[model samples]
Target chain A: MNPTKPTDDARKGDVVSPTKDKGWFYTDTVKDHFFHPRNFMQDESAYGEAAMGMVGSPACGDAMKIWIKVDPATGRISDMKWKTFGCGSAIASTSMMSVMVTENGGMTLEDARKLRPQNIMERLGGLPARKVHCSVLGDKALRAAINDWYRRAGQHDNIEIEQGRVIDATLKITDKDIEEAVLDGADTLEKVQAKTKVGTGDPSCIPEVENLIRFYKEKYFGAE
Target chain B: MRDIYLDNAATTALEPRVLDAMLPYFTERPANPSSFHSMGLRAKEAVAAARGTVAGILNSREDEVLFTSGGTESDNLAVVGIPRAYVAKGRHVITSAIEHPAVLEPLLHLQKKSEIELTVLPVDRFGMVDPAAVVAALRPETVFVSIMYANNEIGTIQPIAEIGKEILKWRKEHATPLPYFHSDACQASGACPLDVEKLHVDAMSVNGSKIYGPKGVGILYLRRGVALDPLVRGGGQERGIRAGTENVPGIVGLATALSLARQEMEKENARLIALRDRLIAGLLAIPKTRLNGHPTVRLPNNVNISFLDIEGEAAVLYLDAEGIYVSTGSACASTSLDPSHVILATGLSYEGAHGSLRFTLGKHTTADDIERVIAVMPGVVQKLRVMSPVNLDMKYFA
Candidate 1:
């Protein structure tokens, strides 16, 4: 859990007290990017391809809004910027993501889209094992941003969709909605229904919804 | 390094005077209080004196102050032990939604075991259970009620005495002695008036650590008739309710610390309240920030605020860098990323719960410390808000 180097943590006289056990939260690299985030998209009125890449429920703790400016002829991400309503690691991870793509003469859209959470974690030294799950939203959001850039350029073939099987025909709620609801602490079918209105408009999806709830509950939370 | 501690509700730095009181027991008197020899008697005398101190403060008998490991243990013994002891009377228990996990978890475990029926009463937007509502929730089968005197996260001081008085009235009217009231006064120990008589509680828990005492020491003030089934069994200690060799040094420390707290509570509370209000005023001045608990009917030492449009851990981290220490109810601070149940119970949304920061004042806190926090807090909040993608709105909160 403590990925912070011993020498860093043992710098006992630093502002961050050794007794504070901050080393357990994130590595110094992560904290650096967190405290001083880079490429934060303060004004994103133009980046309208939104809500595709996010860390948490809007009702909960984390969310991210990412935008990109890609050069079509050069096939390069000329700029990348993001804003996150997230934890330190989430902000740091997003900041690091922007830097990764746009720093030292930017990476191409082709290279940027290939980025994974592991790559971001590696570059950020590493997030805590716990933070690795919820806080590492940068790579996923970056891929979504790249996809958005492709959409803006009208290159329909370039888009990579995170497809979800539609569950509720009337409400257009999908299996992904069920999964998200479960992640937001909707463990049972009734709670999922309450949150997503699943199996309500179309009672035909009721059995499938129950099964999916069971599956997702087991998937995210394990056999509880 | 500049070090400022504002997380006293989590735990306080041990008072030197407390350590001074315990030094002899820790170093010279190594015998267990259970032993019968001279050295054992010395340890026994220290333990008994601690008990006497606790009893005197709570207005309970000396024999009633049963020392345990800490607040968690004291709470567990009351919530878990009392219910099981009076199982034959009936098997229903009551508690608030915002109780510490120590009380809630054990009662939930008992419920899960099919041993007791449980009712969790909800709190208002102020994170206070209406005294009338609590009285209304009581049932004939209710063997116990464990409500915290002050919430850990929000620091809303409960109307424990009012609730206790209501319970007593109900018991007399119904001619039933089934329900025994217990208040977890771990957070309330130092600041609040904790006379068990005035509180009308059958049992109350007070911990050492929160009062600048040694950690790993707490006492359950069980009124004479209130029985408790043992949680830990060994040498038949604590009159068989809590069984372990007595912690002599820790006990002495707790007693010394608690005496100091009681002695200086009035003056300290005045100072802390002023500091706390100044902190609340300063933090709430920041845009989109709101106070979490009740403004006036809260603990004097506590100031909880929800800095909207930003994550709590981020705010906490930034504050840490500025030589300020505080706690947050944010999910990011937890291993499971679960938002605080206490803050959530106040009818704040998950977002608000995630952003809630609690700063608890203590003996060491000063006016300058309050001003320092006030000076630094807005900048931290503004920095995070500028970085956060979420739009500012109190609409998400009801």
Candidate 2:
């Protein structure tokens, strides 16, 4: 789609700005979710009993914390709430993710865990190229919350951890660490190296590090 | 909704007077200046009169000014054109790190092609480039120095006159006319005094849009004997430096706008400074907000502030909804997610740079507009902060 020109749905007053094309780059679904976010936790302290998962950091300009209430009997997420410190994309992604998990009497923890950034992005009529990383936060935080729930319930073996190590030696730099670096606004190889030192020690991992940077950048911020 | 525009630094509404001055050129006087007919002579004369008006503002010779299509083209002509003309004399060039991409990109292109040896001097925390540093960077081969009169994003004004004096002293001592000084005065058109004679600059750039004139027109002041290779080659327009058909309407509007800006500069700056200070003070009053750029030695109409833990783009959108127009560090609200390079150059972290906001006042901006922004900002910021995941204490865990 030509992102510069406003679509019919975009011109239908969903956007409040006088600049008609301000949110034209975004899909109608993305704009809808951004303007009217669902399951946004206005008061962070209100969800005390919910299992929480956090990702990204304020130092990098985008961080998100998701709270989920799981039903012990059915392993379903009964309620979800989140707070995000980022752009419209990050907030909308988390809001959409929360609604997706809890709607229709909620989804099982396993099904929620199966949900990917791609899935959330697809539901939102696709995000802008640069905001794909913003969508990634929702799934990662959801997985972390699910893990936290399992840990609190003493279900140690049920906790699923996706290990992603970019370098093979004692200097533990994982792909997740690189993703975090990208999320923290490290858009270049030099910046990512400064943040994670991923390939400084292991020259063999440099190519892979470069590849991962490209991968995540494309995954999060690339044109659909 | 009552709309309050504070993004004049990005672009300003065309003044009615400027528009009125340009209307005749577009409608009645639509003749090619190149044509020898009476109508064309009238068009040509109008252009010359506008040129004289611009020259008057800069304290320059009327023939010294060359019209182009705004600041970017003027910048390109100076940065790329000067080097191409002076390559035999030297290949080294000097510039500041915080210049607009129009200046930096062309220089970078030259460097990438191995056409020039480039040295980018760093700015202080307040975004001021030191004169001593510029002097130190000079070499026998250094051909040009392009520094901005004032930064667009941060609003910090450079001491162009001081830097010019230092360069002149160096040239006299070396007995070589090697390094020519250029300043992009696009943002400084109305807010700062720009006398090329007083500043001792060889070349300077100005655009019409920033001074409430028409867009798509700019002026590059090339002092006598400072030769630059033409960027656009056509019918020998702009003294063979920039060749194209003259934008008569745009030129007329530009000249009118510049003359008006120069005449009203003192009064306008004082009024803007008061409004700017009030906006700045009110914004800084918010908890954990740090003012960006030089506190006092900045543009009278510019106010840049960073609100911790809240995204600048989000705040901008929120403020836009509240009928207050502002801009953020984000790149045109597009897919490019990198934070502002200008903010980062000042030793601010990526987060701080990304979360920064710029509010640039203009002629129509009133005290009430500033107050409305001040009143609405705190609440918008609070709402975003409440929604932010970053704990004020700086602790995050999964």
Residue B229 lDDT in model 2?
Answer: 89
Give the docking tier of candidate 1: acceptable
lDDT for position B92 in model 1: 86
Q: How accurate is candidate 1 locally (lDDT)?
A: 0.80
The models' CA-based lDDT, in order, is: 0.80, 0.83
Q: What is the DockQ of each candidate?
A: 0.39, 0.40
lDDT of each residue in A67-184, candidate 1, tens digit only: 7776668887777777788778778878888888887678987787666555676777765544654443456567667776777778889897644787765444568667766775
> Per-residue alpha-carbon lDDT of model 1 for B139-200, expressed as tens digits?
88889988899988888999999999999999999998869999999989988888888999
Best by lDDT: 2
lDDT tens readout by residue for model 2, B182-215: 9999999988887998898999999979889999
Q: What is the lDDT of residue A84 in candidate 2?
A: 89
Q: Which ranges in model 1 have alpha carbons more than 4 Å from their true place? A: A1-24, A45-57, A163-224
